[model samples]
Target: MRKIFTTIVAGLLFAVPFTAMAQVNILACEPEWAALAEEIGGPKISAFSATHARQDPHHIRARPSLIAKARRADLIICSGAGLEVGWLPILLQKSGPQVQPNALGHVTASHYVPLLDTGAGVDRSMGDVHPEGNPHIHLNPHHILPIAAQITDRLAQLDSANADYYQNRYQDFAQRWQQALAQWEAKAAPLKGTQVVVHHKSFSYLIDWLQLRAIASLEPKPGIPPTSSHLESLLQQLKATPAKLILRTPYEPEAASLWLSSKTNIPALVLPYTIGGVAEAGDLFALYDATLALLLENANVE
Candidate 1:
């Protein structure tokens, strides 16, 4: 009996270190960052997105499931810049010190990228404006590498034993990503100045990256939903200026864009806003591929 107990204790002791080194648990605020984490961390990390592509990150609730995930997370990756101001703080409160803000495990993608639509005074009247600039930074393929590097560095720092492994993975991803960037830029050359209307600023980075001209938004303000009056005004505006495409994310309601499209004969396109937003956008690379495809397909619509 004594010998069996001792063997069991030894076995449990051995399992502890193996479990500790199993994988770094990452909790990402959105699907895009979660996909980026998977690209950089590979098999060494376990990543879960708190918000899926079909949901708006700005309006998530800090539910118990997310809190539970946060508590176990070794790292937290978020867009930041107050994008998740509504729910992230609640998750952070329930999370451990390791994943808290300013900690090694905390990575904010906005910190590493050049922000757009900044320096504007924010107020409720302006709708859901982020004073820290736009948080939807992932659409710009140019911004991915820096964020990927930051993720790699954070992963290496958290799991030092796999530092070399992470570095090699990052180098490979960087190479493939750079190649894709070239291809995307070349393919998107024709869309450089294509005029379009948007439902929201969700695709600001994407529009900027593709050099597409955004004539107006369906939403009168940043986070405000489109009203009948606003849509009528947009109908009048588009009839005069005449944008070729009406763009919206999968999560946004289709009513406004479709209404305007019906009136103006503009093609309303639903670009996948993130991974899983559309079936074709199953991963990071696929997300951009699908977005560009949709944009190009509708770019010349009469």
Candidate 2:
């Protein structure tokens, strides 16, 4: 009887820690947030991105699998500010209380970061401009620390038992991230004031950070595809005032940027806009490293 009682007590003791160590399932609206969550949450969290490096976050189908993942997620991290306005609300509705907007488990990075291009009154005629402002805040290295801090706070809240662990990890990540930001700023010095064209406004944050001059975009407007007339106009414009290079993310169709590049004799640079955006961009640190390297390489920097 004594031996059986001891065995039961030991089993309970082991089970308690195991249950406590169960990983938090986090559903991130974009790849950047997912990567940041991993940096802060470490092994205590399982981060999943709704969009990949190859997919445009501006538009995504709310597939059943996504709905299912939301349903099971213990927490939600998203850019908000209308970036995922199309489908995230639907996902949240299906996800139930676990990851609701106001719930403790839900954290939107945009709420914690300063936004640009705001108050541009909503007008369908203006193309896909977000009335709330530009949602690509992650590309700005300066904005990342605040977002990471928010993620850490939420993680600590959800798993209070592991609060110290998450905090410690955040401190280490913050230190490394600050170091990387300084290095990136110094390395990107050459790119300052370099003129470029883009497929969309996606690079606004990076452009803003590096002080790169974005002279024009392939799109007629925010989300509208470029019409032949618009492309012709751009070609004419470039003749008078040429840009250094044409820029686009890996997910953006190359034909337009390539067409412009060939006609103008300018290089079309496809940058890794996020973690997993390109082969070399496997994480946050790699994302910035690859971006600066690509921009520098295109500018003929050794």
Candidate 3:
């Protein structure tokens, strides 16, 4: 009888860890995807990012360690649209069979997103323009919702056994996210129709959502940096029209933003374009909150 009791307890100890260790292994190439994967994955997945909030998602270093992690990932998510054209290819080439997914096993989140440009009147002279529209669509919460849904679907595909649990979490998150969107819009309604200057064309979706007018861009053209001629022209335009605020990303050069702001007397509002870009932007919800906060703070009312 004692032997039977001892064996039963031993069995229970062995079974507990396996049940606890059932999390999925996922390696996201960017912070935004990583955040979504974690949210949709719930406690069933482990997601890691190759870059930080302060880093540019467009240019990342391909480290061997990262390749090893990629090799182990069941799914690899990227921003796509040639945004990671600079580095993701190298990681793809270096990732060994450990990470290689059969056509059925591999997933590219970009294919899940709607491409804007798709080589429409694309040219190199456009600075570093993505012939695919903008790869930075994650800047918009509406765009992010679909991506989150996609992540949830892939997780279900990879771990169908716990698919329902993942699905439930996704539905809950989406509902909450939608509610947050409504609230944010309500709070920011006052800023609608306000004119602002953006350093990059990255915020068209957000700008459109908020109904703000973009008076000028710091870049003379796509991929081109701010030049003396462009700055002079922008300052003149701002002076003529009087933009209320300057929306700039943290990854962008503050010098040009400062110069433009100082010249035009419009305060430059530095905002995080992605998750973890700032402490307040540590998560997806806070990200939108921070963005709205900045826009609302700077908006001009007549």
Candidate 4:
């Protein structure tokens, strides 16, 4: 019995080193990307989110701590298309890691999904606009299916020995995710044609999914904050449309939404915007599930 106990203890000690050596490090720019990384990576990944789910990605500070995390990453993922335009370049410069475009550590999930609002024109006069398009594709669950697959492929490239593991997990996740997306679409279908004024261009994918038209915005342009005149003008146009919903993210100012909601009776929905943005949206699937319910509920409320 004494020899058997000693053997068991020795075996446990041997396993600990193996587990520590086998893990992959992931550094994601946002929570949505971090959540996706966790899904595909399972227990073999250590993922870090540069910004919280509730913060606006456009305004994040490229602090020293985030750069330190990036330097140690085996893989770094981000929502490209100018979503992280404000801080990504600074991270690259400060981390000082030469991650080439084709390197294993460099991955952008945006390439996996089809982008919306690509046709929107950009000019400084129109405020801070993404020259590529709206970078908030994660708002719509339909886009997540493809994005997951892309990340799976990326993980395989970075850690070829674990390629099969990533692929298996991706296939399983895709099946479940597709079912969730289907339910959301069906639930939100009734909201089709609901005119909404988005605080930013963040919900272009959601607007496309629900067939909701963006009549105007609280922000005069893409990245600029709303002016008094802009809000006043939008209020006038939307006052008569009682059913029109105003979509705003968790980080956006509630003052404008509150004012419009009071004046025009439009319920300003402070949505999760991304997974983990709110306590209710604890995971990737819950974020969309919650958002769809809110938008649909408000559509019928008036």
**Top-scoring candidate (TM-score):** 2
Weakest lDDT window of 10 consecutive positions for candidate 1: 13-22
Q: In candidate 2, where is summed lDDT lowest over 10 consecutive residues? A: 13-22
RMSD for all candidates, in order, please. Answer: 3.1, 2.3, 3.5, 3.8
Root-mean-square deviation of candidate 2: 2.3
Q: What TM-score, over all chains together, does every model reach? A: 0.92, 0.93, 0.87, 0.88
Off by over 4 Å in 1: 1-20
lDDT of each: 0.89, 0.89, 0.76, 0.79
The TM-score of predicted model 3 comes to 0.87
Clashing pairs in 1: none
Which runs in model 2 stand beyond 4 Å of their true positions?
Answer: 1-21
Candidate 4 lDDT over 42-152, as tens digits, reads 997888899886688888998988877877777888888878878888777755453434465777767768887677556446666667777777877777877787778
lDDT of each residue in 15-129, candidate 2, tens digit only: 6644254899999999999999999988789999999999988889999999999999988999988889888988888777758887888998899989987864666566765
Cα lDDT, model 2, residue 276: 83
Clashing pairs in model 3, backbone N/Cα/C closer than 3 A = 24-44, 117-132, 117-133, 126-222, 127-222, 127-223, 128-223
Superposed model 3: Cα runs more than 4 Å off: 1-21, 96-107, 113-119
